[model samples]
Target chain A: MTSEQPDWIAVDWGTSHVRAWAMTNAGKIIAENGSAKGMGSLAKDEFEPALLELVEPWLSAQTTVVACGMVGARQGWKEAPYAEVPCLPFDGKTTKVETHDSRLDVHLLSGLSQMKPADVMRGEETQIAGFIAAEPDFDGVVCLPGTHTKWARISAKEVVSFQTFMSGELFACLSNHSVLRHSVAGKAWNDETFETAINDAISHPEKLAGRLFSLRADSLLHDLGNAEARARLSGLLIGAEIAAARPYWLGMDIAIIGADTLSGLYSRALELQGCAPRCPDAENLTLAGLAAAYLTLKETSS
Target chain B: MTSEQPDWIAVDWGTSHVRAWAMTNAGKIIAENGSAKGMGSLAKDEFEPALLELVEPWLSAQTTVVACGMVGARQGWKEAPYAEVPCLPFDGKTTKVETHDSRLDVHLLSGLSQMKPADVMRGEETQIAGFIAAEPDFDGVVCLPGTHTKWARISAKEVVSFQTFMSGELFACLSNHSVLRHSVAGKAWNDETFETAINDAISHPEKLAGRLFSLRADSLLHDLGNAEARARLSGLLIGAEIAAARPYWLGMDIAIIGADTLSGLYSRALELQGCAPRCPDAENLTLAGLAAAYLTLKETSS
Candidate 1:
């Protein structure tokens, strides 16, 4: 099997890029490929070519491709309608798109949407599925912090409820576009600054906006160092997010999934709030999710 | 007085623009002028030329130019050292800049600063001065809603203490630069939507970051209108601001000095919170502040 062509490809396609892994029938990663051509950049018809462009070398007859994330969005390759929650993160069925290449059988997984408080998430669901796959009966919270930080409550392998915070986007906008940009220096992290700011914001969430301006005022008047300002800015945003997500994470055993630094930051923030969350690499969870989908699809086909 | 050349000039120089009124010795506006060349755009030396270009026709020998706002900021035309608060908003002993044209005597007014909580206000202090000039015994909170909405405590004709909120800047950043930009349509505003969101935010201020994402989700799932989303965004920000500023405006008489629509929003939000704010035109207040400073300067010179 190692010498032969790969059995399938597992993909995590997001807004800005597509990452695919060639896999053996036994779910081993044979090889990995990626491209900047993501769902955001391509038209509906262009997705097939984009996928083939990245994974063509490893493709063979009946090489199934299971993709997740924005590729299944309404404006993406195909509108894989969302799976409304309080359900298993992965139901083992996905939306399939017609492929021009007969060698490929592509399935795009649907994202999850909540109706009550009104929330939706893409790509992260696959990561959640992967997380559940690892700990089959994991019953608590799984936090995925990224461009949109998600706090999901999982009970007996089902995502009970969740909330999303635009913390990452807010951080980007403030650091790059708002008046705080002047005060916030380069990408530097300070634990003490981050902790203090987080505590201040959490203790007085209403004063968040005022504290944001104080960053600029402090920089101007006290000549606050850029590193501290940058860290404090991150701390403030994350603190507000944690405050909002208290119901989800306060008493729950938690696992955090994302890039190393971000997950670490969330981990530390939660620790300050008295919860120590388990940290997991986001990419691994995404891969595990894609693999689960592919195996389920293979079982159904057989 | 209208026919004769003005005796002096009143200037409100902010980050992006400069507005000036040519005034008689008795504080009557004889003419008005403005230009996009504000403190933000001009270098230190270019400020004089920029000012001259706008009000050059009104200037004659010994015509004193009194300027306020960011023009006196460290990065502005010239640094007018801040006057520590619990003091008068303006002392009239301002930073004087040398001009190539002997016709102008430019006096830049200093802003007010609070050292304890670490806060500062530029153009707003001038507006507060104007508010004071109108009601010499004015005592209470003055709310100035703009890019940086300020809540200033005024008593005995002096600004005692103040705090600044990044509400307006947050609205702009989220609407134009974040993922929420996709859901928010044009510049449409809804009062009912604004009021409801304000109440909701005030009730649960900590959930602000989460509610922000709900606007995006509501658009995705429930087809939240662009107008409603826009208004709700404003409501959420203003709501959080009000909640934080409760201590200042809760039991005190309040006045809102700002642009028409923005001040109206703050006024309505405050009213909902049960404080009926006095709405005063921001420009009028700025003019009155400049006039007061001009009069003080005249008396000192005499």
Candidate 2:
């Protein structure tokens, strides 16, 4: 909506949504917009129109568009194959898209994959890059809590290895689709209950499946409140993830990069295990990561 | 429809479906029917009509209909309060429901509950009772694997204690709703892959959350087939359950009562841990349990 013309575009195109920011050549934001036309909802040819729907007003002459996330997936407009891990987050290796509009020069960033554990991440690599961009000398684990939470070991500005946990997706599925849906209906939370559940799950990770059904039993027999049930479910899921991820965060510097609410829970869970983690605002980091990619592309071309 | 009037009716009304059998006084089945009108689908007031719709043709004057399962839940036709465990699965403790039609005399069976660990079961109690009826000396553990799998310790024909696992529901939720849904799409299964996954999960129950995500990653990177992914998912979940229910099955007489496919999986998983479990057909046990309750009622009345 800005009257001034933009120099380039930055897009964080994920599975369910597409976020775009019109930025000056200096990385200063001019305007921003987003749409529900994410990679999941769009066909191969529809990506251009979906992108143009949001960034059309900011466009002038030929402008470079840099994007990250699932837009680089196989089903995306153009597949930006994953780069193996134990390398830099981003190094100007982007997949160029052939667009109909001459004013659009689109580039999708490469995601990172690990060969041994057989894991791959698309959007998170950008956030990790942004974190590295902000803290070049940062050496430790970067925990990104999200739909598929990622735990990456970073050393000397390089991603050594990473693991992904489907805790967020599992929470969504359990709360909305599974039998626990009836028990955890409300949005209310109990911190004490959460802590207790986390401790129980972390201490006895094997009992998790049985403990899950106990939520429904507690609701039926003991009148466990919906809020407490919700907290307990979250705590239990996060606790299990933490139990498995102990080796990654145990005795290492940890920074949790995500939204306040999820990050807060992760921070509290880590604190319970005698480790302190720094929570960084997720949006800023995503934008920073896109900008980092943009700056690299510009430098290489120049 | 049968020309002869039935002596009584046996019903297993669960969350999603209502199954009925027209039985003679001597427990001879004359006809059987089922409907989608489960306790979950019908309101309290509508339960009678739904029941009559399926059993009306089989009903005779003043027929006694004994039903089990979620039909006795709080939201069911009439709340059959849960009986605490350490007692027989069914001991003629039935909740009588007032019906509009004089021809219908409905008695809903009480489910079992455990207070300490907090667990409850509706229809599985009937299956356990049936198993005990067939093997009156079943002095070990009875495992009923279904939507909410139940593991009950049976001693002297009593359900001493029990635990419920949401592994079935978890499997349904993850394979149908989560990111893994895309990976595990076919009905195909691999026994070897399933066995390997079970061992992996049983050995390190803590790594379950991480392993779930790997299915998706493996599909993307290593061309993991849908059948292999599905089998692996099942193995991991059931293995975790076995790991937690070790106390219940280890060095004990184990009887698995459920549908053939699921019961077979539980049997195989238990066998992997050096336990030989007897797999019994679940339907026969339900009818046996109902007949047991019906006979007890008739004896008391006479």
Candidate 3:
């Protein structure tokens, strides 16, 4: 471990994983670490030790920690109440966590929730806050694709409304657990198959169930290869999601925040839908979100 | 172990289990037995042993054994090639298996497959054939709900056309494997939830992806009960299937051949859609279909 003391710590704790970044006061990253101990694995008391296990090498006697995501959920380190929409992703407030280590000061950022449509997001709100932090005056839709893909409308630096889709989860379950598993067992990308399936799904979204079973039947009757099956499966799901999310991205300035391959696929899908979306790295946005929270904590303390 | 010689044996061998019925010369079932030995678990050579393991007690010096479902699949006891649609479910011709035991004469019936829309059914075809045997002049839509539900058009003793939906499989996968698992872990059926979800899904089928995640979020935010979650999951899937199969079931005489609860659910959904379908016991239909095949075999031999 380096002898140089860190300025503060930024953490993104989710359901199945924890990621931390040690940073200088100026927001320059000094070190990065992570662990499989996510909120889902830890009890309320274990949250502190789980965090320290990963970032102890970089901690000082009295270092401040700014964390986002599920770690701030009701079941996390502490319940940082959600900032209800028609409001900023975070209302410039962080809940202070009581820690056993006298030297540790932790601030957990709250998430965002919507009532009318019944929606909620934990970690992604911080990422949205970070994106807005970079573009202070941004007003448009931000699409975050993941296990539970989210689409949110931002107007005047506040989230107006949002919707969540189980597209990624649906794709995984159908491909790995359903009858389609045998057909789409391997990785092979067929652009034509994907595009065709996507278009079909969008055109006739009601046929989704029938089309899903065809993948299995086609493999048995028509010798449909694994790649084509996989591509068609992905295309059908993404197409269905996009069809449902049309009101959010139709003829609007849109930005998608997600990982590499998934984001690329979303980008291509958007382009196919005649909307060229600006793509950004999801990890960067997460760190920037934690940095924003850290800066706010510092300002409040001073 | 009664010493009375059995006349014939009927089998409904599917992917997960095998059911057999020993009958008299008058087609009266004297004994019924089965085992976990499904087509999926047996190799070509093991199928004979699997069958013998269950029905050996009923075997005589010469016993006629007739089988249907996946047992006649390419991977089953023997390949009983599918009879093309616009034809009888079985063309009075069964694939005879060359058995090691001279006392056993086995005949496997073919399933029905449609080429235009690309669909196939193995075991369900036997159920349909049985229905046709009971109602020879019946001409309408037959709905068989199961792991892979089949909707078929029966006219003039032929399966004119058919479609398969993965509704049951979708429900199982989403409830057990997807993010919705936490929301719907146990059997808690709420009628209101099921009816409401079915109506909504049928009205706006595209919103399915969005509505699915809401189950999880609602459980987290609104404390949605597991019963409601389970009911809604089922409603959403079945509703989508009904919407897609509208062409088959709409304004037509519909008969549902399935197990008790699932068939009951389908009957309710159809009734909600303004169609009261006739509910038939799937087991009875299978046995009747086997009897029809047995009768045909005897006629040809005599």
Best by DockQ: 2
Count backbone overlaps in model 1.
0
Per-residue alpha-carbon lDDT of candidate 1 for residues A2-107, written as tens digits (9 for 90 to 100): 3567888899998888998888878778888899998889998999999988888886576889999999998899999888999989988899899878988899
CAPRI category for model 2: high
Ranking the candidates on DockQ from highest down gives: 2, 1, 3
List the global CA lDDT of all models: 0.89, 0.92, 0.88
2 or 3, greater by TM-score = 2
lDDT of 2 by residue, A1-302 (tens): 58888888899999999999998877788889999998998999899999999988887799999999999999888989898989999966999999999999999999999988999999999999999999999999999999999999999999999999999999999999987889999799999999999999999987887799899999988999999999999999999999999989999999999889999999999999999899887888888898888888888899
What is residue B255's positional error in candidate 1, in angstroms?
Answer: 0.7
Worst 10 residues of 2 chain B by lDDT: B52-61
Q: What does candidate 2's lDDT look like per residue over B1-302, in tens digits?
A: 78978899999999999999999887788999999999988888999899889998987588999999999998888889888989999977788999999999899999999998888999889888888888888789989999999999999989999999989999999999998999999899999999998999899988998899999999999999999999999999999999999999889999999889999999999999999999877888899999999998888889
Better of 1 and 3 by DockQ: 1
Model 3: per-residue Cα lDDT over B1-302, one tens digit each? 85666789999999889999988778787888989999988899999999888889887678989998898877787898888889988789899999998878999988877787888899788888889988999989999999999999999988999999999988888888887888899777899999998899899998887788888878888999999989998999999899999999889999999989999889999999999799988888998889988999999999
Estimate the lDDT of model 2.
0.92
